[model samples]
Target: MMFLRYLAAVPLIVLSCAGVPFGYLTLSSYLFQRSLPGEPAEFDFVAGFVGNVTALAGFWPVPVAFLLFAGLWWRTAAWPRISLLPSVPTAFVGLVTGTGWAIALGVALPLVSWGLARLAARIVSRPISGDVRRSAVEVLIGLRGGGRLRVQSRRLLLDRLPPPRYRESPVGRVAIPFDRIGHVEAGVVDAPAQWRFGNTSELTITPGPALRVIGSGQEWLVPVDDVDAALRLVVERAQARAKPEPRPPLESARWASAKKLWDLGEAQLSQTGQRKVRHGGHHVLLVLSVLTVAMTGYSVFRVFTDGWGFLFGALFFGAISYGTGRAWVSAGATQKLAEENPCSPLADDPDPRHRPITGWSYQPVVLGQTSDL
Candidate 1:
């Protein structure tokens, strides 16, 4: 199993590092020339542009793809019958440049996967969104009660969690239909007291109101943002859906759904911050780009001078410096951000309910070194 994991990871690592523009460039060039026989000049220009872009975008998907693949594998590696097939498509998508067919395949495959999963769920259990089979419901977060609670519409989907808990489940969902909904309430809860030095300390919870759905002997407390517009839309949509006669959708209701309103509120809150700090990591990228260009120039020089030894030395040394610089810059930026906003999701916290209550999960700390076994 360990051998298989290492084997699976090796190819993805190699592809992310070297396959990006080069392999795709070659494949795309051949494809374009064959497909567009009449447009030879256009094809040449397109192929050359893609190749150059990929070359410039060094280590194409490595930084992002490496972490994603490793994280997924770590979780399921212990399972005897683990399947890494679901991650294959995404891994492939990350190998290519973020353009042309790559973009289409990357984006389309994930959407199709999600759609198919939803379709299967509907087939197995009763469809949550009655007549509107494909209901426009967005899940803000998972509810402890069972499945996730839909943001606006009076709908709830069953849990997709693995067996045991699923087997013991009696009911798939509990939803208060539009007309059945008695009243909706939104309010804020103060952070629970924290113990420090054997004494309680009062700490203000992160910004945002919580939602409470009350009707049909069920009251579910959802710990997501409770924007006024979202709460108002819930009432309005319920009224609309409950109406006896059919009518065209209202203008506000058509474009701005409950999810949109929640997103707008989130944006507003983020922008509400008065303190401004210089953003991080762009300068690191600028340095990387400059070094890459310098390396490219040297490669050209070495080709003319036939300086193989110097070329190899520069390549190895430059890679080490680049890796060191990347690691430093990433750490520095994260530290700066955490220092600036201690309560931000990126910071460390001693609070146990940090994630469940506030949706602020603690970021994992990466030590500078680990002792050898």
Candidate 2:
């Protein structure tokens, strides 16, 4: 099934790209009465030779590049392994599939390399520095003494500076002490906007050194001078806070009955994600359609001239090329989704993390969590 889909998509993509120039040629031939084969036989011979040489050179490089990247990735893994020969077969298969296959493989290889690099980095990189120590304390709501203090999470390491402490009305259950903070600032620095939760109001927090913190399993940064002191204060306050009332578990049969309606909501969300992908494809198709019309118009004009037939042939090729380009893009997107969310034959499970790369589904990662802010 996958192979069949790929076959259908490849030609469409190739045709889409080839259409434009072919159309232009068609128009030119009709208007100027030019011939496609007016050149010497030697020109044909030379073109064929060049084409063959280019194809061979292009095909040969695929395995080499793939092996190089694979080796680089392996070195970064916990257990490095070499499989150059295995990769070579795949590269050869790509070569046999012609220019479209070669082009797609070329584009996909870099992306795959990037993914491997990221995975390797994650495996090899050290955890955040644990040297600094600070104290955290709970402060009264609307209190004046709490200078700006940063909120931080332990899990994140990037751009994490301490923030100044402030008193909010009915202040939250826990707060870290100002003295425990290593660094403090008045405003949010290069923090991922999602951390703000779409809140427009700026909050301030201060000791004046850099600090990192974790909240709800995610990492955040704040200015702090001492990590130990800040952590102590936070621990102390959290211990002192009043516990909330217990809620009923939703895993029971009664709740399960009500959950059926929520399943529909999930379905809606999935549909929306799919629609966004299709909408992007629709935009591309619309552009191609407009270009096709323009090309056809040019070809019609050329029909009155001596080279009309050649112009029409080129136009046909151009259309095929344009179609191929579109199909290729669509198929590539589908392939990415499929790879990310492999199907399981025995279970009817849908992966919740399989988000389409469009519309509101598109999100920025902060401390390893996707956030809207």
81-192 per-residue lDDT for model 1 (tens digits) = 1111242344364446445655554544434433433332233223223222223333234433222444333432222221211121122233444543454655554553
**Residue 217's C-alpha lDDT in candidate 2?**
17
Query: What is the C-alpha local distance difference test score of each model?
Result: 0.37, 0.31
Name the regions of candidate 2 deviating beyond 4 angstroms.
1-279, 306-373
lDDT of 2 by residue, 118-201 (tens): 333332221211211121111111111222342222111111111201111011112222222222212223322222100011
lDDT at 262, model 2: 24
Number of backbone collisions per candidate, in order? Answer: 0, 83
Q: TM-scores, in order shown?
A: 0.27, 0.19
